[model samples]
Target: MVDTGSANRRDDRTPVLAVAGIGKSYAEGKQRRTVLADIGFEVARGECVALVGQSGSGKSTLLNLLAGIDKPDTGDVEIMGRSIAAMGEPELTLLRREHIGFIYQFFNLIPTLTVAENLALPLELNRIPSAVRRQRIGDWLAKVGLDGREGAFPDELSGGEQQRVAIARAIIHEPALVLADEPTGNLDGRTGNVVLQLLAHLFRDQGRTLILVTHSRAVSEVADRILALDNGRLTHDTEALSW
Candidate 1:
């Protein structure tokens, strides 16, 4: 969430993404492994929520389902009241492209594309005017402190810098929801903290919704609410302190 003004925050206060009774399972040879079951939550617009759990828990799976990247075997996901299951690929693609931004722990920049090119990819795909896209690219670059390094390739950047570029790419369109999967998992603690702080600042400053998955308590503490997952179920929900 960016520093949304009071009026903007109020306008975006309604439930933007809702999840209910989501369950997913996959067969492992002859045995079925349940990845998530009956997990339910809602992320309000302009809010930051964290889902924390040990490995094998369903944090990533749940995030994927909510993001419309994966279908749930059972349960319904409603985004701002629309049924996710009812969407076809085109509708889903539109929903994701326009309303959702995803951030991965490992920066997944295109190896061959420069930082600026990567950031503009989504907007260009959506057919935004070049002038608007260029301005947005510039704004994101500035926000992430990479104004002059946009020409650099992902491999030329440090891990933290790479992740920052990833962040810029994610938020350039100002999506209603940002789903982050272990956004800091690949970095050192110090670097990870810096990434987390950047995320926190974005949520606070931009007023976009964030649903982050992390195992670190330090990361979870920044969220307005923390959802703990275990063995494919959500086990805990706590409201953490705000910035």
Candidate 2:
């Protein structure tokens, strides 16, 4: 039997992710425009949090800060109790490679690589043995319902199939956190729902933490908590408001 108990096994004292007083800005012309300001929150291990905002609301910027892909002008992002601000480039790269997974709206699969090759990228980067990597690739392909299509390239698959491969690629390394940016934005309603269900199943069943950024209310509802961003500031936290 699968171990459902894994969900309850996390230590409640230390959150998987913490953000404090984060601020970011960009130079537009002569003046700087703020994208995010003083954003702070924490996501507990095994919890799924949705970040909701309208277009140009800085949701994507925040996700980048969380992933160490971009730096905040002020404040710190702590993942698994370590501050990302203190890490240099190499350390940050390693941190991302080891602890963070990302799913993008574009299904960012390499056009040249087959589905299995794309799935195998993370495992290879982390130096998982070739023998074990093959097993994991096989297992995840089956899990995502793309088992026999491993040889297919990205262009050969439908939108949903490509997304399934992306999801499998994101989680196959067992990263401590997953950040999804508009995961369903590129699909139709029915396909999006299927992807969401697949994500919910994999993350919840494995006791993984997810921070999903979306504009859709229906998509936000999938999370255990919702955080709403408005005009560069955090306007609502469902956990804080007890909604």
Model 1: worst 10 consecutive residues (lDDT sum): 6-15
| Model 1: number of backbone collisions | 11
In TM-score terms, candidate 1 sits at 0.91
lDDT of 2 by residue, 110-207 (tens): 99999999999999999999999999999999999997998999999999999999999999999999999999999999999999999988999888
List the candidate 2 regions with Cα displacement exceeding 4 Å: 1-12, 239-243
Question: 37, model 1: CA deviation in Å?
Answer: 1.7
Q: What is the C-alpha lDDT of each candidate?
A: 0.87, 0.92
lDDT of 1 by residue, 1-243 (tens): 676697576656658888888899999999999999888887777889988889988777788788887999988998866899988989999999988888998899999999989999889877889999989998888888888998999999999999999998888887888889989999999998998899899889998889989888899988999888889988888787632
| Residue 182 Cα positional deviation in candidate 1, in Å, after optimal superposition | 0.6
Model 2 Cα shift for residue 180 (angstroms): 0.5
Clashes of each: 11, 0
The candidate that wins on lDDT is 2
Q: What is the lDDT, from 0 to 100, of the residue 193 in candidate 2?
A: 96
